[model samples]
Target: MKRSYLLIALIILSACSDSADDSNREIDTVILNDLIQHSTEFEKKVYSFENGLHIAVGYGIANSIMVEGVDGNIIIDASDSVAEAEEVYSYFSTINSNPIKAIIYTHNHGDHTFGAAYYYNLEVEKPMVIAHESTSQYVERIMGILNPIISKRSTRMFGTDLPSEQVINVGIGPYLGVAQSPIGYIKPTLTFADELKINISGVEIELYHAPGETNDQLFVWLPNQKALMPGDNIYRTFPNLYTIRGTPHRDVKSWVKSLDQMRALKPEYLLPSHTKPLTGDAVMETLTIYRDAIQYVHDQTIRLMNEGYTADEISHLIELPTEVSNSPFVREFYGTIRWSVKSIFNGYLGWFDGNVSNLDPLPSEEYARRLVTLSGSEEKLFLALEEAVQEKDMQWALQLSDSLLALNYKIDSTNKLRQEAIQYIGGRSLNPNKRNYFLSSANELNRNYEAQPLLPQTSELLREISIDMFFEILSVRLNPKKAKGITQRVCFLFDSGETRTITMRNQIAEISSTNKNCDIQVKTSEQTLKESLAGVRNPVLSVASGEIDTGGQRTKFLSFLSNFTE
Candidate 1:
C-alpha cells in the first residue's frame, strides 16, 4: 500500500515521458543473404525452376513458396528483408541479366511487399507495382495500426526490451532470440481492385482480390503451368479464421470459399505466402483439412452465438472438432483458432458477457472508493490488486487499477508496481494480443515513472487522433448488445481543407474521408488520425483543436458519439 501511494507520486512527476518513438528503422544490408534469420523451415536457399529460366527463392526451411518466371529474374516475395534482398540480388546476378523483371506482389501484407522495394533501384522502369485495390488499403491500415503495435509487442514478447541472450522461445513463433528494429511499410506503386491478369516472361499470372484473412488479399493462378500461389491464404496455418493483432472480423465464409476455389484447382505445385511449398495429392488433402479447420470454427462460433452464448463463453467452449485438429496442415502458428473464433463472434456481435448486471455497470474505482470507507485504508486496495496480479487475474487487475488510479493519482507505486506486475505476466504470456496489452500498459506506466511531470510533444503527438477512434474503443468497452444497431457518421475538416470520415459499425470504426465531399468534410486530419490510431491522442482535446471543421452538424455528431460506450 505504501508502494502504491509512492508510485502515484512518481506518476505525477513522470507522466511526460510516455511518448513512443516508432519511426522506420533502417534495414541492415551487409549480411542479408547468408542470413535467412531462421524461421520454422530454417534452411538455406533452394533453387529449381521450369527450363532453368525461373528459380525458387526458398525461405523458412523448405522453399515454402517460390517467385519463379519473373520477366527475367525478380523474386515474388523478394528475400525476407532489405539485407536478404541484396543477397538474393547477388545470387540472381550470376544467372539472369533481365534486370529482375518485376515483383508480382501477391497481396498487401508486409512480408510480401517490404523487401521488394529494394529491387526498384536495380531496374530502370521501377518494376511495375501491382496488387489488389484493397492491397494498397491493407498496407496502409497495417502500417497505420497493426505494424507499430506488433513491432512494440514483438520487442516485449521477444524480450527485445530486455537483454537479448536472456530471451527464450515461448514456443509460439520462430524468431525467439533476435533484437531488431521495426521495418518500414512500403507503399505500392501499382494496385488492382479485383481481378487482374499479367504476362510476365510468358508466365500467365492471375490476381484475384479475395477478402479472407486480409481485406487486400490475392490468389495467383498459372493455368498453363498448373501452379497456384494463395498469397497468405494457403500460407499460414489452419484456415486463419482470425489474427492475434486486433482487427476486424475476417470473413470465414469468404475464407472457406477461397479454399474451396483452391481445392477446385488441384494444381501440381502449391505455393503459400509463408511456410514451405507442398505438392501432389497430399496438397489437396491437406488443404481440405485446412479449410475444415476454419469452417468448423466459424460454423461453431455462429452456432454458439445462435445458441445464446456470449463472446467469452463461446471463446472458452469452442474447439476444432477431432477431424480438423488431427491434421498436420491445420497448425496454430501466427493465427490461432481461439482468436479466430473471437474475431468472428466479435464482428457479428459486439462484446457482451450476457449479464444484465454488466450492463452499464459501475467503474471499478466507484466500487473501490466505496470499499475504502468499509476497509478504512489504502492498504486494503493494495492488497486487492496484489492478489489479483498474483492470481494471474488480468481483467480484474485492469478493472481495479483503472478505477483506483482514476480515484487517486497521488499514489507512488501505481506505475512501478503495475509495470513490474504486468511485465511479468506479459513476458510469459502466449497470446500475442493479450501480451501486447500488458506490455503496452507497462510501457505507459514506465513512461509515467520516467517523466518528471507531464509527457512532451512526441507523447502529445500521440494525443491528436480522431473521435471516431475513441468511439470504436468505447464500443470495445461496451456490451455487444448495446453496440447493436449503433452507428455513427461524421466528417472532420482539417485546416488544410482536407476531410476525413469517421464511421463506426459492427463495433469497428473505419476512419476515412475524401477531400471532394460535397460539404468539403474533413473526415480526419493526418496528425489526429495517427495519434488516435496509435493510442497517443486524447479524443476530448482533439475536438477542441480548431484544426477540424465539421461544417454545421459536427457538434451534435460529437455529442451522440461521446455517449457511445459510456
Candidate 2:
C-alpha cells in the first residue's frame, strides 16, 4: 500500500511542473538539465500504521504525525499555525478521544512550531512542549532583531503579493494562504541537548539532535512502533542545502553525520516533517538516496573548492552524480542543486570568489554608469538586453538589465523590459523559492520601490521575551546621532520587585541586573516597559497615567526616554 501510494505521489510531482515551458527554461541559465523524469503520481492524504499510529500528510507545507499512546496521544512536528494545527487536531480527534499528553517540536521554524498553542489549548491541562535547548536562541533572534527584515523577505519568498495565476506551490506543499500569527505557540517546558528518551503515555520516544535544516533540529524515534521522524532532514524534494531567504551556511559536515545516524536506525517507517510517510523498503531506499545526494554535493563542492574554483565557476561545474540526480526522490521541486552548490562554496570558502578585481569592485551604481558610457547610450543597453531576451539568454539579459536599472536615468522602457524578463525567467523556475524570488523581484520593479518597515511594531514572540532580551533588543534600536554627547544611567524598578540599571553612553545602552543611583529611575511593570520601548505607549502618557513613576530629575527622565524612540 505504501509503495503504491509513493509511486503515485512521484507521478504527481512530475505533473506539477507542466507550467514550465521550453523557452522560459532555456532563458534561465540557473536551471539545470531536466533530470527528474515525469510520472503521474498523487500524494497520499494520510497514512495509518498499526495500533492507530496515523501520519497526516499535506496539512500545510509539512506533515504532522499522531501516536496513540497508552494514556494520551502525542503529536510530532506541529503544522504552520493555529488554523492548520486545529485541522490536524480535529482529524485525530475523530480517531481517538484521548487527550494530548505532549507536543514535540522538530525545530523552531514557524511552520513546525507555531501551531503548538492550538494543540496546547485542546487539552484540559496543557501538554509538555519539548525541543532542543538552543531552540530559544533561534526563536529570540528570528522573532526579535531579525523579525522585520526576514518577514519582508518571506513576503517575497512566499509570493504573498502575487496573484493566484502568477504564484504556485512552495515546493513541498501548496501556498500557505495565511498571514503570520503567533497566538498558537506555547513555549517549550522541556529541552534536551543530546539524546533523550522519555515515556509518554507508554510510548518510548527517543530524540536525537540532527542539525541540518537548523542547528536545533532533532529527529524522533519510536522503538516499539519502529517509526522514525527525521523532521526536515529528508524531505521528498532535493534537500534545501541553502535557502535563498538568507540563512547562515548550514553545517554540511554535521548534516551528513546526522543522516548517517538515521540510516543506521533502519526503522520500518519513515515520517518526515514535509511530504508523505514511507514504510519498509521505501523507507530505507529514500533515506539512502537522500543521504547520498547530500554527500555527493558536499564532497564534490569541497573537492572543487580545494582546487581554488570560484563560487560562480563551481556552480557551472558541479552537477549531481547521474545516479543520485536521476532518483525520483531527489528532484529539484523545492530546493535545487545550483543554489546548493553556491551555498556549499560560500560555506567552505568565504564570499571572495578568488578574484582580485571583485575584492574592490566599483559600487553597483558606478559600475552601471561605466557600463553605459562604454556602451555609448542607455538605448544601446536596452537593445542588447532585448536581444539577449530574444536569444533566450537569461544571464546576459539580467546582467544588461541590472546595469540599465543601476543607471541614474530611469528609462521606463528599460525598467519594463527588466521586469518582464525577470517575470519570464521566474515563471519557468522549477524551484519554488527561486520562482518566488524572481516573481517578487519583478513585482517590486513594477511598483518602483522595495517593501519597507518590514517588521511589525510588536509581536507575541516579542511580548514573551525575557527582561534581559527586552533590553538587549532595545539597545540595538539606539540612535548614535540622537545621543551624540549625552550620557546617562537609568534604573528600572518593576512591580514584580525586579531592578535593572541601564547605562547610556557613547550611543550604546548597557543593561545590568544591579541597580544604582542614576540620572533617572522609573518604576513600571515589565509589560508596560515593553510597551514604552515598542513606542506603543508614550512616556509622557505613561507618567500621566501613573503607569510609571519617575525619580531623580523629572526633566532628565523625560529627556532620557525621548532619546529612545521608534
* Highest TM-score against the true fold, candidate: 2
**Which lDDT tens digits does candidate 2 get at residues 319-389?**
87888887877888777777888888888777888899999999998988888789888778888988987
Model 2 is weakest, by summed lDDT over 10 consecutive residues, at 33-42
Q: Any runs in candidate 2 off by more than 4 Å, and if so which?
A: 1-44, 177-182, 386-392, 411-413, 448-460, 532-540, 552-566
Superposed Cα RMSD, model 2? 5.2
TM-scores of the candidates are: 0.64, 0.87
Window of ten residues with lowest summed lDDT in model 1: 24-33
Per-residue lDDT tens digits of candidate 1, residues 1-566? 00122232232223222331222011111121111122334333544556332333333111223344655654565433444455556666666656656666776554565555467667776676666765655554444334446555444443334322222221222322111112322445567777888787666777777778677777877777777777777653455566543456678788888888877878777766555566678678877888888788888889998998877778889777887787756655346766777788878876665679777887777777887667676677667776876675755665556656867844656545566567655544434334444555576565433311111123332332233443344434444454467666655565556555556568565556533334224445666655643445665556556444445455764554554444
Q: Please, what is the whole-model Cα lDDT of each candidate in the order they appear? A: 0.54, 0.75
- Candidate 1 contains a number of clashing pairs equal to 42
